[model samples]
Target chain A: MNAFVQLDLTPLLIGVLAAIACALPGNFLLLRRQALIGDAISHVVLPGIVVAFLVTGTITTWPMMLGAGGAAIVAVVLIEAVRRLGRIEPGAAMGVVFTAMFAAGVLLLEQTDTSGVHIDVEHALYGSLESLIWLSADGWGSLLDPVALAGLPPELPRMAAAAALIALLTGVFWRPLKLSTFDEGFAATLGLPVAAISLGLVVAAAVAAVAAFDAVGSIIVIAMFICPPAAARLMTNRLERQVAWSVAFATLSAVLGYVLAGWGPLWLGGTHAVSAAGMIATVSGVILALACLLGPHRARVGAAREA
Target chain B: MDTGFWQAFLAALALQAGYNSALVAVGAGLLGAAAGAGGTFLFLRKRALVSDAVAHATLPGIGIAFILMVMLGGEGRSLPGLLLGSAVSATVGLFLVEWIARRTRLPEDAAIGAVLSVFFGFGIVLLTVIQTMSSGRQAGLESFLLGSTAGMLYADAVTIAVGGALCVGVVLLLRRPMTIVSFDPDWAAASGVSVRGVDLAIMGLVMAVTVIGLKIVGLILVVALLIIPPVTARFWTERTERVVWIAGALGGAAGYLGAALSASAPDLPTGPLIVLVSFGLFMLSLLLAPVRGVAAALWRHRRFQHDVHRRQGLLALARREAIFDRLTLKVLRREGLIRPDGVETPDGAAQAAKVLRDEKRWDVARRVYRDETIAGRYDGLTSIEAVLTRDEIAELDRRLGPPVSVGPRIAGAVP
Candidate 1:
């Protein structure tokens, strides 16, 4: 009973919030054909986090977020520059910039004296989701009590704020985003600030990424950014329904993945839980795979139905 | 800075002194060349990022192969066994990308991203399982993620060498068919080349190279080895054959130098260093390569614009007076096209006659040709140096009779 009470729910809540936040802006990226920008930004943020840690001598929230946001902007700019200047394909350009940035992050981490810091290089790569715990909880009721809310992990509120920000931004810019994504030339002809809207989307993705990085890490964040939105895209051609489906899929994966990570090992006769973040990513992937194989709107299924 | 460091660096560089490093370097170099050559076709086909998906997909195979080997009570890290597993998984990944693109409404980029992230996620799950296993030997499997060449044995090097050689051999044997398919699969198919067969062959070669490259550069950075060299080579040449050869050379050099440097500095990982080195080479090629490089192209464009302006100035002067502009005359004299006294030398007479003839043709074309035809021929007229065919000149003559004397009449102008 005590173990159950002591069991923290923050990780699950944070995962859900982060997953939803990532998926919201991720739909625009998918429609824009920039689905992999999330992957690129995830990698490029490592150096940002590490540099922030190095500069501030602490792994605080704002600095890391600021650093990551700055890094994301730099990554977008650099990717654009490489694409335009080298006349290289966007994917290859992205591959070059992100890999180099990630390499630089690794090298920097190795060089810096970060022994005393709570965040290590391994933590940056795979994340430290296991460490997130709320020990002050006495029972499930305490989680609902405002008194016990102070005991909640800071990552929860951080992720919640980020989710709100992303949701707000997506709502505000929904029309321009949809217009530009569907037809950039038309949007430009209409004198819509297509470039600004696109940059705003990138910035929104960056914020969600930074917010999620503390809880789920970059790999899972990247998976969330593409897999749910992509699966949703398969399920529907309509953008509104797609966004709803993406959020639902993301939430489903988060809850199910967290449960599986915590309890699946016990079912399999192991004494310990696996990585919740990795499990989340794996679940989203499984959902995407299933969607690919069995979605009603999938071309294979549609073809079979017609036949 | 110290003698010990200097000695170690020298020993690292001297292949004879460090046999293990030499073997690893040679193996990596061979892998690099094979990937580079194979990657040229992939790049030309505009499927460069497919290699990324293929590379990430190999991780799960390695994990699965290790688990199977452990379950079978054999050593899980057997080179051939692991590589075979990697090859199968990479091929499946390639097939999935193709399948998704073909059977679904999703674009190729989304398909690739889906496969890459999902496969990697599954691999991480498998890795987590491997970590939880009671077996202690599973520790070495993590090296496949980031790559570590320090532990490569001579047998491992030989395996890479043999595999790389086979991939290169296949690429060389089928270069012509591969080029045809890459450039124009429809035409290749129409011309009796089995486009499907060639595509499968190239995909097979990419899978082989990617799997073999996994040990040296790891999964994440292996695609860089496949892409950067070929992309850099593209900045230097337009011919597929030259691109392939240059890409191979650049990949080999990057792999060789990167391995040597990493061997000297044991702290740095070989995979990222190799990528960084190749990236450096790519940057240099992007900036400095002769034809398509940014700097060279910019200079050529500027020079072309300057020539256009000079020719326009000369035409303006010739239109106003029988003599050339002073600046044009100075340039022409420097090129031995004119005398210092501003009279047309034989070469100058030919150039001036050509320019005057172009000006007269412009006037005749304006009156005789319709606006649409003149617009169609606008590029030719603006170039001024375009050599008109005899038929075109005769057609112009028939329409306008002799060339109109619009510009200052040169003595030896073509009539």
Candidate 2:
């Protein structure tokens, strides 16, 4: 029992699932020119969390997740309305909506301390990954069947849920999502239900955002969403290749980040072990930096070569 | 809201009793407008978003300044020392962003975003360290997070005023050259305009305004102030000169309003509020402008539809008359394919042609038709005795394609 508990594979498993879930939808967000929507949504979700905490008197995951999701949808709606009614450009509208929502959230938190729910600005920004303390028995059953994965432990359930959601979303909207991202006007002319596809993409991103936020804070969630897609873009300009590379990169970062965080303390003589989320961000950033520097399809190099 | 606004206004006036805050606000607004106006050219040049990068890119420099202040044991009480450090760090950051771009394959936007995030993260890390080290009094660093007019001493205001005046002076002196560069960089270069120098000058103006406005608007809202007002002003006019003037005014108004709000309500963050207000103004311009507003476009579209239908009705009536009269048609036939007796007829031809004939031309045509022919159906010719047959009018319609795509076939279609 001591060995089983000490192994502490639960967080690592959850991290993997979260990263996969995020990277899947994140690919479309990056492609659709809504690259910063994740950042926008992350900030906008603050007020939602505040409201949820105020109502529930606790910082359990579900209320905060639901609240964050609702706020994100509202943000998307607000951005659209602002663009239509005011003729403001997309980027400017997004900036205004997110900043306003974030400010409102901050103001609310400052005005009310609530019943000491412990969901403060720190939690809003840097998340409480340590909350993955319980591993559900039902979670294990769904994750593993008798013959399918009998050897796997109960921790696999969380990973299975994350993987299943990501896989299902990716499978369902793969074609239309790509078409909408490439040319929205053309997609509409083809009688594609553009509104439904766009909504699906947003919902997918919100789900992915919640899943990733559970492991890494909102601040780093943006980096996770943007960095992998950006790095993949650097490696290959083609959309298909970018999605493939992004998923692979995200999975690798999760495993490596968890391993480093779990074991590096033993070697370095410290309890703080470099934050796994930070490490993941740092690694992803480093990968992007490398790709930017060395990638062949770079504009300047391509220009120089053509010249 | 009204009473709150008035109270806020009075409190702001009181805060500016010595006129120091007022002076700083004016200086910042002037400098910000100059930066923003210059941004118009940059924005038009498709590099508006670079301002966003430059704003965040300054963070590392601010962090380095904080570190230096700590090293010199002047952390909390030294404004001059901090400013000097920040200036050096900011220039370094600018240099690094350019260098990285030169050495890499990153597109400009992605490169800008990356540089911004990395430097901002570095600043956050430095700030965290600074917080940890301070013991007796927390570093009064929260001011930088959302600007503090409480620190706007007279000297700071003067420094900003000088910067603003210098920016405006330089822009005036180089206005012609800058316009040439903006309108046609290649042409300016070919005509010996020193394109590189003009670009460097514009960049210098951007840096000066950013540095000056940093104290008034804070880091995050500085870019918005610099870009949004100029973007908003663009909707009201087509001329570049008017755009510059209006944009400058908008920026100044926003700065004044923001300062007043901040002074009155001490609790509200000034930068974000100012940005929100500016965006509100931008929305107003988009909706209500007479010439280019969305409302105007919709109105013009309706008017155009009405005019087209009215003209089509006149042409249809004229075509009916041409089909019956042979001698009157022979007179029309000589007027081209609408020949009265033996003119050619295209399958789908309108009879009435609304040509832009001058009075003299109409008088001459009327005289020619007086004794030419007075035969079959000529009722449609009563308005203007000179007749035009269906085929001739259809030929004219074929030459004029409607500007916008109407629902199906254009009503002005020859048929």
Candidate 3:
């Protein structure tokens, strides 16, 4: 029991917080049809992190976060430019820019002395979440104590703060975002700064992505940004409920994925567990699949009936 | 900078020196051509990123295939076996995307993102598991994550060549139907073309190309080979046939050049350098293509705006002779439509009269015509006569007086 409390709870807390943070802005992205922009930002942030490491000669959070945020904004700008100038579809434009950026990041990592650094290319790609440990208490009783809380992994508070900022922003701009997402022309007629609101939403998403990057990596960040909102969208039609459901789904996947990753291997006769981040993404996928199959929208049944 | 580096680079580039290098180049070139051709249809269909989803989705199949092979007492590194697994899984991923799109209110992008992340995540889990296996032959499988041409065997090259050729051949045979479906699926369906069948065929070809290109470009970058060449080709021409051929050639060139460069530079990876090269071509075409390129488009827009300004200036001068600005007068004189001393030429008189008539006609139409009639007839009109009926013209004549006749005092007219 002591081992369980010490070993599992911190990672689980970090995962849940990160997932919820991502899901907040993800709901808007899903609504705006920019779900993949989250994916793109996640990919493009690698070079930002690497460059930050080179500049600061440390893998500290603030510089890395700033660099990643800048890269994410650049990614958004480049994607827009490519889409507008080349007359390409947004998805293809994103694919082109983000993949190139990621490839450049890989190349840069290889060329630089950063290869020996803690944030190697492999870590950037797969992540090392299992190593994020925090043991502040002797056992379960003191786990919630102030000293214990202070000893939590730094990622926990950083992710929580980022999540809180995102939630606050979303709450403040909820009406404008909803109006613009559903009807941009209508929002414009209402004299709302539709473009500014949209940009704000994108910035919020980027912030969320940067916050989640160190803990879950880009792959899980992308999955959280897409899967929860999508599943929530399937389950409910109301925007408010969608956000709520998304958060719920995000938390559920985070906790469930942690459990499965830690114990799933034992069932398969393997001595070790798998990647928690990967498992979290997989669990989100399973939830989305279930939502598709049996959500209140009755998608499959309705399609069959229509046919 | 160093002699050893230069020496190694030269040795790597010797044209006839290594059989394996030549084979890898041919295989990559073939794969690029096939991906290019297949990508044209995908792009035209506006499903360019679907191939990315498909490519990422292939990783789990690779992982699962390796485990199955090892469990069954066969070498898990067999190229065909792994590729087959990837193809099957990629097809399944495609089907899931389609199903989700058809069944739910979720947009296609949401569906694609979901399937891509989920499948890739599962694949990563499987890969971690595979790493712990006792067989210890998992080293070759990691190349599928980021392609490495350094390990290309002659047999692998043959597999790529044959698979690529098959994909290209199938594309050629089904070119007409594929084109129809891609451009206008509704029309294709109405015209007895099985839209779904064509879609499946294209998807099959995409899957095949993605699977075959996996070993060379890796699954992550294969979509680049698929998409970049076709996008670049689009800049050069509007014709589908030309686009296909150009894209294929560009893809082959990028692949060949990229492979050679990667071989020359020991530090560079083949997949990214190839993508970067293709990206370079895309940028060049985007800037330099004659008709659709950015520079050309901007030039066209400027010329159009200038022409509009000149026409407006000419009309303003024609409307009020007191405003006979020197520039407008000079332009009219240069065109031999007007003479000096403000005398209108016959050509100038005719043009001025037409412009006056058009102005009067539009004025009457705007007030007198019903909104629906105006919209139906006058929308996108380049000439006033095209939208004006006899009755409307007569009405304009009665309401706005007879068209102003060009006389000597009106403007300078050159004989």
Top candidate when judged by lDDT against the true structure: 3
- Residue-level lDDT of model 2, residues B247-282, one tens digit each, is 777876776666665556545555655666566676
Pairwise lDDT winner, candidates 1 and 2 = 1
What does the lDDT read for residue A20 in candidate 2?
Answer: 72
Residue pairs clashing, model 3: B342-B412, B343-B411, B343-B412, B343-B413, B344-B411, B344-B412, B344-B413, B345-B413, B345-B414
Candidate 1, residues A1-307, lDDT tens digits: the string is 5455566477778889989999999998988888889988888888898889888889788898998889889989988987887888888788778877776776677668777877654466557666677787888888678877788788889989999989998888888888999999999999999988889889989999888987778877888899899899889988999999999999999899889988999998987787777788889988988998888677844666664
Look at candidate 2 and tell me the lDDT of residue B326: 41
Candidate order by lDDT, decreasing, is 3, 1, 2
TM-score, B chain alone, candidates in order: 0.81, 0.71, 0.78
Superior by DockQ: candidate 1 or candidate 2? 1
Chain A, candidate 3, TM-score of 0.94
- lDDT of residue A146 for candidate 1: 85
Most accurate candidate by TM-score: 1
True contacts kept of each: 0.45, 0.09, 0.58
Question: Over the stretch B239-337, how does candidate 1's per-residue lDDT look in tens digits?
Answer: 888889999899888887777767776577788788888889988988898876789889988777656645654554455555445655656567776
Q: After superposition, how far is residue B222 of candidate 1 from its true place, in Å?
A: 1.0
Candidate 1: residue pairs that collide = none
Interface RMSD, all candidates in order, equals 2.1, 3.8, 1.9
lDDT, residue A285, model 1: 84
When 2 and 3 are scored with DockQ, the better candidate is 3
Instruction: Give the true-structure RMSD of model 2.
Output: 10.4
